[model samples]
Target: MLAKAIFLDIGGIVLEINWRKTVEALGVFDRSQQDQIWSVLGSAKIHLELERGNATPQEFFAFVRSELKLSPEAPLEEAWNQLILGPLPQVDQIFDRYAGRVPLYALSNTNRPHYDYFMKQFPVMKRFDRILTSFELGHRKPDSEIYMAAATEVGLSPSEIVFIDDSPANVDAAGRLGFRSFHSVNSVSATLEILQRHFSN
Candidate 1:
């Protein structure tokens, strides 16, 4: 079946964001203690709260800093923004390869600071037909609500959309909703291969 719309995750698929690097930069390493830092570093509920527009990045980072026992004036603000190092190397090529075939959308689970920082710093992603983030939609991935919203944004049914993400759980969630989902682990080329093999023909 051909995908009428393609929804891709940003941090890992379209952008090379080293969330761990940001956590390490904050000097938080222990797994037990890393819980607080992990929330800001990975797909945790606290991070989702920020992406859901419940808390500003400043407020989120302030909470992280307080958990780490760092001063409010500490230079960790830049660390969160630094999570987005740059765009994925194959972004332009990938988009160009599939540009007019179907509407492409950024269905990311990210917050405003990181999103705004990347939009200005990495203008290449503007090529996507739409930008749908948890911040704007007020729902995160693995939740059927977000997937349904994405399908709505694309003006297609879940089965008509191909959603790709690096996380197996997210992919599984989308698959359960009838999407042609791909677990795109660390390679855009591989992601394209999956699309071509599964959805394109």
Candidate 2:
């Protein structure tokens, strides 16, 4: 089906993130310690709470410091911000090819700090017609509520929108909701091809 609009994911699709980098930045060099730290930081509950706007960034940092036994002066915020490496390669091609053809929206599960950091650092973000973040909406991906809310906000049925995300679960969730969804798998070129194939006309 021809898409009336497009929803793209940010973290893996538009940007590259390294959880290990954040761990290292936090001064954790031991492999096992890094794994354990990342596991805690990346847990579904903690991530969901933060991205769902249920917890403030200050609360998150404080929890991390306390749980990880970090020094009182540890640069928690700075290191956490390091999770976003930068934009992916050739991401511009997606906008270059599809912008103005249809509404392009960014749908991401991100907290305030990372959202602010990426928005400031990446000029490409300005290309989206709108941005829908979990933190802003109080819902995260793989949940029907967020996708339904997004569809409602865009004034379209799920079937009319093309949703692209790197997470298989998110793609499946959108598809189950009747969205024309694609799993980008961290490849901008593949996402572009899918858009071109379905929406190029």
Candidate 3:
């Protein structure tokens, strides 16, 4: 089957992210401070809400400051954007090769601040025809609504598009919806093989 569009996840697929980098940079100087950070911000309820676009960046920052007793020394962007590292070289080549040939889009679970920082820091991401983020769409990956919206955004049935993500849950979610999804955590060559199987190499 030929894929008319491609949906890619940003965090682990296109760029490198160290999730713990946030707590570390935000000055987790002690065990108690670390515990406080994880207990509150890392909590499923709070963190999921943040990813699902319920809380704005400022709101999350305020919650962190108030709950974690963080000083006002560091910039809020730094704390939140700490996870973002750099681009994946092979992924960049993949995008450059298939960008205009196929309609490439980003379907990521991320908040507003993270989205803005990524676009600004990695201008190459602008090549995507569209970027559907959780913050903008008010839904996260593995959700039926988001998957449907992605199909709509690409103007194709789920089977007509290919979704690549590092999360197994997300891959399974896409597969359930009949999307030609692939798990991308283990190897880039493997992902390339999946794409080649569905599209002209």
Indicate which candidate wins on TM-score: 2
Q: Which 10 successive residues of model 1 have the least lDDT summed?
A: 36-45
Model 3 spans > 4 angstroms off = 29-36
Q: How many backbone clashes does candidate 1 have?
A: 0
Instruction: Please give the clash total of every predicted structure, in order.
Output: 0, 0, 0
Question: What lDDT tens digits, residue by residue, belong to model 1 across residues 76-181?
Answer: 8677776677877777877887777778888988888888788888887888989999888888888889999878877899888888898899999999999988
Residue 75 lDDT in candidate 1: 74
Candidate 3, residue 176: Cα displacement in angstroms equals 0.5
Q: TM-score for candidate 1, please give it.
A: 0.88
- Please state the error at residue 28 of candidate 2 in Å: 1.5
Residue 68 lDDT (model 1): 70
The superposed Cα distance between candidate 3 and the true structure at residue 11, in angstroms, equals 0.9
Q: Per-candidate TM vs. native?
A: 0.88, 0.96, 0.90
**Candidate 1 vs candidate 3: which has greater TM-score?**
3
Candidate 1 residue spans exceeding 4 A from truth: 27-36, 39-45, 198-201
Descending-lDDT candidate ranking: 2, 3, 1
